[model samples]
Target: MALAATVAGAPVHAQDSDWLSYRDAYRGMVAFEKYGKPKQFLQQHYQVGARDGSPLPVDFRLALSGKTMQLNLPLDAVGRAVFPLLKAAYDENAVLTVNRKLGAYVFRPRISIVVRPDGVYEGAELRAACEQALDFQRTVNAAGYRDKHCVGVRFTFAKKPDADVRWKGGAPLPAVPGPAFPDEAGNAYSVVTVRFDAATDKGQVVSQNAPLAVSPVFE
Candidate 1:
């Protein structure tokens, strides 16, 4: 599986009784709902793209202030790793960072999505103006970024990875070599990531349906 190529540290395998799959479990979540509990946080994904809906090297660590550290898996690979829970304490107003290795250096690019009473966020505009400082380092990267390891980091929206960002929903995300997310500044960043205001999601329901079908869409 493509995700098997990307997972780190843990060997997540699907068995007759156990496996980790995110997109299927999430998409069919509606079929399993028996109770609805109000939640401040919801589960969503960081569907990056070489364009807008792609995945990155399986090695990058998408850290959310240690509250959640993700390896931005493709929808088909969520079982390998998932931030199954999103809490207001863990996500709201927290600074999110992407820590990855390029040869001998570690680059930490950051952003914060603080939910305001007015529902506004710092980098919702996704411009260099929205780029956060790299507390992990004080030096510009080999790429020559001044303060942050990135400048052109940007974002666009799409249907949730649960449905749209899949190998079958459209173009199969290539494990191609290039900046994972295209830079508006056109710099060749070694890694890029996406963020969601978990506290503002549509929330989940109790599933009553059979287990989700985790096969690759075109399989």
Candidate 2:
């Protein structure tokens, strides 16, 4: 909640130079789609953020526009959107636009472990999922992720008072205010982080409420 500022304080405007070419974005997204690796537990999304890597405003959006195509892209809590690979938009040379000044925002791909519908996860499964994500990053040439280890996972919940997350048959985990994904700039959410050290790696994490997303914590 505190991590994001409302758009009401920031004027939303359109600048020609701020638009991103759809063709270029398509190529970047296709690379992940074509990657052949052990990534069943991982997922990829197109994320929009400020050029300066600052936190995104609440209700932020990225739109796809062209001569004959117009669609609004909805963003998750972390400014990630499910990028649509539309052939029609590509043929029309559509551009991705946002309501911000020139050079204020950028778009990039984000990969993370998938969230389960049941809101329950095995510690070992989470570690394996993180490994899959890390391996995918290395193969894609993300030098920053190469040497890091999966130390934990972060569960981001909605801004509600009853967001409960804890270890199974145990007390609730400590809730902190932070971004859903590490290094992501956006509005803050209620987060419960679980570390995978020896004492804490054998139990199942249970979430009484569904989380918006679950991100791996690498260190």
Best by TM-score: 2
Query: lDDT: which candidate is best?
Result: 2
Q: How close to the true structure is residue 168 of candidate 1, measured as C-alpha lDDT?
A: 17
Global CA lDDT computed for model 2: 0.72
What TM-score do all the candidates reach, one by one?
0.21, 0.81
**lDDT tens string, model 2, 80-138?**
88989899999999988777654566556777778888888887888888887777666
Off by over 4 Å in 1: 1-46, 52-55, 66-81, 84-92, 100-219
Question: What is the C-alpha lDDT profile of model 1 across 47-91, one tens digit per residue?
Answer: 222222234455544444333444343232211123333344233
lDDT of each: 0.26, 0.72
Q: TM-score of predicted model 1? A: 0.21
